[model samples]
Target: MSTMQPILRSLPRLPAPNLWQSKFKGSRARGHLRVSVMTEDAADAAVKDMQISDHPQRSIIEIFPGPGQLTRSMVMAGAKKVITVESGETFQESLKALEQNSEGRIQHFAMNPLSDPFDEILLPEHTAIPGLKPQSWDKVHEDVMIVGSIPNSATGERVLHELLTASIQRMGVFRMGRVEMYMFCYKDAVQRLIAAPGMPPRNRVTLLAEAAAEITPLVRPGAAHFHLPYDYQLLRLVPHEKPKIETSVDVMDFCLRSLFTNKSHALNKVIKYERAHAIGSEFLGHPLLGPGAEILLGRLSFDHNIKVKHMTLDQLNEVALKFEQWPLRPTVLYDDMIMYESRRKR
Candidate 1:
């Protein structure tokens, strides 16, 4: 429904860039990289759905915008400023063309988003999210958007995790505000983001994502969507207005890692096999869970035989709250790799 949508649809398709034309000459040869081109209509629809046009002063930090396909749509849709973080030089010509056309409205960063400190290179001075300040965790702002199609790998997942954690912690790429991320990732990555308590493939990421943000499916791949070898989805993640648990992220992180060792096993059954030796060490060092796993388990007030997959979000929050009240804090170093070995044995 945007004015740009019609204009973009009528423009003639340009020839694929040299990197994509040759396909085998550059990063395409690296095998890990993939560039999924979509029609201008598709890009326009995606930008419109994100509501970027609603904000006249919107700023976007896009990751891995190979050759600026979506970037063009964003600029056309009226984003106030656009900054793309891309490392590969293969798309330099096309992106430079976009920059030249924007007349200073668009900028490009020739750096890896995963390794670079965003404040140092990615975000320009005026682009910082309003009302953001150092060491201010509770401060809230809503002017910035992070949009990208991340690579489908552990490294890509790690980068997203780091970005979300930094946002929650009010550091790194998140200094501008609690960012809203719209990411296109493989179906498996999507599963990890939306995984529930007792679902298959549930693990650390499930709790980490749930505790930090509300993940919603924006688009599901279908015949009309962008073509790719594997099905993928666009997910929207916004920080939770009120997190289910009000404990240290580290505490909940340690607790979830310790308890989900045998995720399918009943909570009572797995607790016995967890590294009790590490309970006094630094590994299971959560303030509440570190000292009193049994106590928190009792507070759950559920059948000890319940599998973690079956537990609801409220039940998980109950566990966290119970840990906060424990008077005697203990330290632990439970072997975090218990679940990995369990999966291998299965």
Candidate 2:
């Protein structure tokens, strides 16, 4: 029986080809974006790496689980329950079969985790697994975990950015408390997600992600699978019990976008240039200048020539909070109208 275990664990052939290819073409085309763990060994390794058996009470929310390979591994590894949110229909038959065999342990939701609002999809009644309860904003929810493989494409990047933003705002899944995320991301995206201040890859996403969660790289990129064009690294993003940045998500977004326009430029110079209608002039009255700027720099104990890229996460948080509290700050920042319309629709 011990010897036969290896053979029993072998994986089936890869999923259909069209399922892996992006639907869009030309400039918008991202070739073979959907990467899946093709072998049972890889699937089991991922489940083990994520420590599925450690928390038997925690339910998993899996995104883009192609052919339900890792999904089965999670269940076999002792996951109490798995709620699969798969956007594509190509794997529905396989997922439905898994659900039928799981004796209510697995549930499938045909929704796009990226675009669909959690409030609309992951309703309390629908995800009513034992031990999973709403937790305070400053507490980590140990009962639920999110797992998935992110595609290597613009769509994937945009979704990750939105998720980080939602986390910072304590909206969506994050509203249930500091829900933890274990995701397989392309190597470059993982680099940017975990990049620190002064790192070349540090950008708005880096700042937002750092402000929202404690991101750890659990697995380094390995040899690419036959169906994948790039190697994917596994990341564990645990939302901070209390977010590092206390300002509104809009304010933080605005500040990061403004500062990172010329990330290498001196902080004072950037503010002065911005105020002078030389950079980000549309947001001229932003609090990144005048007394607000002076106070932020004073808090950081940094000289006027300090580059924006060199500021730490706390320093960046200070900038955003100061901007938020500025008495004379503009009533609206860029995209305020767009956001307002979006909220109205919802």
Candidate 3:
């Protein structure tokens, strides 16, 4: 696949971008929201920034995709298929609209995602993807899966499971441009239900590790999480003994710093993560150095966190071991303006 104009624009923007500027580079930065932050614009920029491999032979595959300004931009850029799953016919339609109005081709299919036979919708050209009996979209650009508090709301479960199934295989193969899995998010319940479908412990660990690999393989959140109003959380497929937040930096910094001495003074890593993400193949030999360090890295590294607190301690240990080289970080920080928003809301 030759570099298309769409591809050019999709590439991640350069370092230290000015948030207020028109070329706002990142998708989810520290801001005033309480959920994941990837405007259609940010998402679009991500796809473009993650240009299809220069190899021209390695294809791209996208999972649990949604429609909006950014997704539309992806289809236009020449991604063969952005296999997204949605249960609601209406949501599917809304997502398809981006493709419909786009200069690109899009295929939207209505799979209950939970049990709906995927075969009904998946076709060579359309975007509805079925179980991984692979032929290839061959041109997959990036893997995009975000598990966060804001959720798809309407049909998240169906969409999440299906996308996860599709994306897990690519966990290492394709670098995650953005994945938002976390503990507090409602998705945690969904994850807990699925972790041991009689699945192997090692397999689960592999998935968790791979998820870490996929999400941050390319993109990294900044020194600060998104602003105050924006919501974000860290998740694990299994549980662990770590600090977490229902809201804000004060409590967050307190807990983590108490656990790790320098955690408080350390500059937010969100910016570094984002910049490193653009560079690709993330390996923090000693990414973190503290009790909270592993937890922080795992949460921020890939932009995805799985909820494991509800799981058994045994399960937690199985997955928690990775905190040593945890992929996430305490990189995200709330913006000053977002602080004002919180006060205003009160």
- Tell me the whole-model lDDT of each prediction, alpha carbons only: 0.63, 0.71, 0.34
Residue 73 lDDT in model 3?
42
Off by over 4 Å in 2: 1-28, 124-131, 136-139, 274-300, 336-346
> What is the per-residue lDDT of model 3 for residues 1-346, given as tens digits with 9 covering 90 to 100?
3343343334322223234223222233332112323354444445544553332322223333332333354554555445444443324555665545433434444454445333344443444332223323333323322322234343434344444443343332222222333222232433333344233232232233333223222233332332212233333221111212132323232232222222112223321222111223332322222324544443443322332222332333332343323444333333432443354358
Residue 253, candidate 1: C-alpha displacement in angstroms: 1.6
Q: Worst lDDT window (10 residues) for model 2?
A: 1-10
lDDT of 2 by residue, 30-88 (tens): 63477665556667778888998787777888887866778888887777788888866
Higher lDDT: candidate 1 or 3? 1
Tell me the lDDT of candidate 3.
0.34
In model 3, what is the error at residue 310, expressed in angstroms? 15
Consecutive 10-residue window with the lowest summed lDDT within model 1: 1-10
Candidate 3 has what TM-score? 0.34
By TM-score, is 1 or 2 better?
2
Clash count in backbone of candidate 1? 7
In order of lDDT, best first, we have 2, 1, 3
